[model samples]
Target: MRVAIVHDELMRKGGAEQVVLTMLKAFPNADLFTLAYNPEGTYPEYKNYKINTSKLQFLSRSVKWMQRLYFPLGVWAMKSLKVHGYDVVLISNTHSAKYVDIDNDALVFIYTYTPFRLAWEPTSYSQYVESRGVYRWVFDKVINYLREIDRKEAQKGDFYLGMTKETAQRIRDAYQVEDVTIIAPDVKTVNFKLSDKEKEYYLVVSRLEYYKKTDLAIEAFNELGLPLIVVGSGTKADELKRLAKPNIQFRSGLTSEELADLYANCKALIFPQYEDYGITPLEAIASGRPVIAYERGGVLETMIPYRGDASKATAVFFKEQTIESLKGAIELFQSLNFDPEFIKAHAEKFDEYVFIDKIKQFVTDKYRKSRQKSSPKPKLASEKRINS
Candidate 1:
């Protein structure tokens, strides 16, 4: 059957993009549909695919207006996507892709990283609009308007694949749709390896953003006077670097091998972000490094605790997104003894092969059921007698 795939954006390479890459492997012939596409901005591997973009993509090729008005415009552009001939339209996104239009018989299977991250989290949305201008209220209205559209679009899906149990509940809360299946994203076990010798520094692999609470990590490390490496680039990169102490190092444009080396040698990962399904902490744990993270979102689903009532936890949690809490968690992490082999073993559950297998089975099962329902047939008495 002809299949189509939609993703939130191809603007950059991140966890979501990696998930799309996996999807492409699962459905090799599927055409990629998106509101925008930038071969340079996204993963170079995506250039191998036949990516069909909306008109908005061509219009914003030079100016990149999508970065500013992505929600409203992206939602509008995606609604124009025609997914009629395909038997299944598998969509992946933190928010936008679900709005893509589908024909009556086309089955929509959504692999949501989160149910519109900015809409569900007030602080994040506020940070987004606050960064824009004095007309925060006007922006708020616009977001709310987009949210209503997003909510309706969500129900159009035949099924929802939540990255975690917490995210499944969050999906229900966001869209009031209970037909969700749990499917975890995976890590490249071969890419990350434990180091023979570890350094006396912390690490954070997050896109620099206010909502990520990266500022807290920087502030805490500044006081600790320990080497902390922040590996990522974003709009907040300059501001975060400016606030960081001399001990804090910023590394961007590092290759996967280089990143794995950094991961192998770091004391532990300091994860301050509240993500839907964070892949970085798992990657660190896979590299045999413990993680000290805020206790919220997808981390709660993936990370294990070393303290009371814990069961093979690969990481520890800070109660709040504050310097004091993180500093205390760091102190707590130092006092514990985490087995590197144990951490790596726990991380194996999220290997890329496992995730791909699950996706194949899920989509295949869904496709079979949809086809069966559409062509409703009963077993003949002769067939039943022969079976009996």
Candidate 2:
């Protein structure tokens, strides 16, 4: 079968980007499509693939600038992409790449990270943008326009594959469509080969962005007066650091082994963000560290919370995305004793083997169904007689 892979863009090697990489590896012969590609910004391994990017890639100079143009020009550019030759198109995306024009007979399965957050959950997206001074009346009108188009495209999808059940429900609500299969992303469990030594400090692995609520984590840790180490860097780093107390530490550019060691040593993984499907928490769990996460999004599917049986729970949940909730969860985490064996085993459940197997099966099934759809169904003799 002629297969193709479509991603919204490649700017960073995040969990969503990792999914695209996996899909590309799954169909090595398939052509890779994107609105943009930045060799410097994302994984270097992506250069090995046969990539086809839109004209708009030139217009979207930087990763940050692409955010503003993605809705306006990226949507238009992707919508006009002529994906006529491919028999099966597996789109690993969160944004407007879903609206690409493909052969009517082709199986267009959207392995979605999310329905565009700006379209579906406008509040989180807007609050950040408005804070940056772009959320004027003109911007609201443009957003409304984008949301309308996005909703229309959502219904046009042949099938939807979500990373979590929570995302599936969100898609269902946003698109008013059903048949969203929950296929979670896998982590490279082997990379998290860590020692059994537990450390005093807790860990935070994130992009350091506003939506992530890293600032809130810093505030919580400050109030608790505990050692908190935040890994990774972004635009919000300076601001987050300002909010942080002496107990908080920021470290960037760690090697894979070093990251694993960090994960292994920390008391627990702190994930303040509500993500489509977070891989960092699972990686920490694979490293035999329990998670202290904001109890929403994909974490809900992965982390089994600590009840009376601490050995059974892979992680602890904070109810609200507030400093008080996080502080309370951290205090609770200090009291509990987690089994490393249980935590490691829990992470193994969504390993690369399982994820690849499921993707292969899903794509094969969808391809067969698509072919069947293209073939004509026969009418009964009575119906033929009536026609005559």
Candidate 3:
């Protein structure tokens, strides 16, 4: 059967993009569809795919602005796509793929990271505060309209797959849709290895963003006088660097191999945000380094409880995202003992092979059920002779 996999954009290789790649590998014959593809010196693995980008390629540089102005354009664009030939369509979305149009007979599966959180009351407050002027006013109205459309389109899909339980709960709350399945993001294990090197300092690996709470990690490290190494870059990089103390070092644009090295030797990984489903924490655990994460959101599901026993605990939890909470967790980490073997074993649960197998099973089962329902019944011999 022909399959088409759609994604928001192939601009960056984040957790969402990794999910798309895994899907493609599982369905090697499937064609990939996206709004834009900015090579941007990404992983060479992407170079081998059959990619079909939208007509918006000319406006690729300003796609972000365009999304704000023409919020429903993605849905409209999909109406023109020749997906009639495909039997199944899988959408790996963090944004607008829920708006895509597909044949009624086709099986459409959506992998939702979150259900348009920016349209909700308390969440939209944060979005509005981060915007300015007429653009802000215009976007607020546009997002509300899109939220309604998103809910309608969600109902058309045969299945909804969430990357985390937090996201699945949001889907239920926002769209009032049930029967959602949770499939956590997977980590690449080929390049990463368990090292015997002595741990030196703590590490934080994430895009520098306001919502990520990188500042909280900086503040905690500063107050505790601990050496902290930060990897990854984003809009808040310069601002975060300005506030960082001498002991906190900010390095951006490192390859996955380089990050694995840092994860292998770091004393512990510091995750300050309440993420949807963070991959960095899992990577650190795979490298045999324990995680010190805020005790909320997906972290609660991923991290093992730290009870001052090195042989038993794989991670420690901080109940708050504030500097004091992180500082307290760091102090506790210093006093506790952690086993590297136990940490690595916990990470193996989300390894690439397991993730790939799950996707294959989900898609195959969905397609089989769809075919059975659409199959025609056998005609009686007398009815068949009438045509003759």
If both were scored by TM-score, which would come out higher, candidate 1 or candidate 3?
1
The per-model lDDT (C-alpha) reads 0.81, 0.81, 0.77
Tens digits of per-residue lDDT, candidate 1, 1-388, equal: 7789998778876888888888888889898898788787777899898888876786655324775666556666777766568888899977778777766567678888887766666567436645555566766786698677777777667788989998888888888887789999988787899888847788999888767788889999999998999998877899998999899999988887898999999999999978878999989999999899989888887888767533366888998888899999998877777888889999998998898899988998889876777555544433211110
User: What is candidate 2's lDDT per residue for 1-388, written digit by digit as tens?
Assistant: 9998888888766888877777776777889888888887777789788778887788887778787687678888888776669888888877767777776556678888888877666666535466545546666777789787877765546678898888888788877777899889988898886575648898999987768888888888888898999998877889888888899999987766778889989999999888878999999999989999888888888889888899999889989988889889998989999999888999999888788889988898878865666555544432211110
lDDT by residue for model 3 (1-388), tens: 7898988777765788888888888898998887767776345578898678766555665434445434455555543444456788888876665555566556778888877655554242445677789978886787777676666666656688997777898888887878799888788766678888888889999877668888899988888888999998866889889988999998777877788899999999999888888888888888988889988877777778776576787788988778888888888889887888888888888888888899889999978876777555644433211110
Assess every candidate by TM-score.
0.91, 0.91, 0.90
Question: How does candidate 3 score on lDDT?
Answer: 0.77
TM-score of 2: 0.91
Point out where model 1 deviates above 4 Å. 61-64, 126-134, 308-312, 374-388
lDDT, residue 196, candidate 2 = 56
Off by over 4 Å in 2: 126-135, 372-374, 377-388
The TM-score of predicted model 3 comes to: 0.90
Which regions of candidate 3 deviate over 4 angstroms?
62-82, 121-127, 130-139, 374-388
TM-score of 1: 0.91
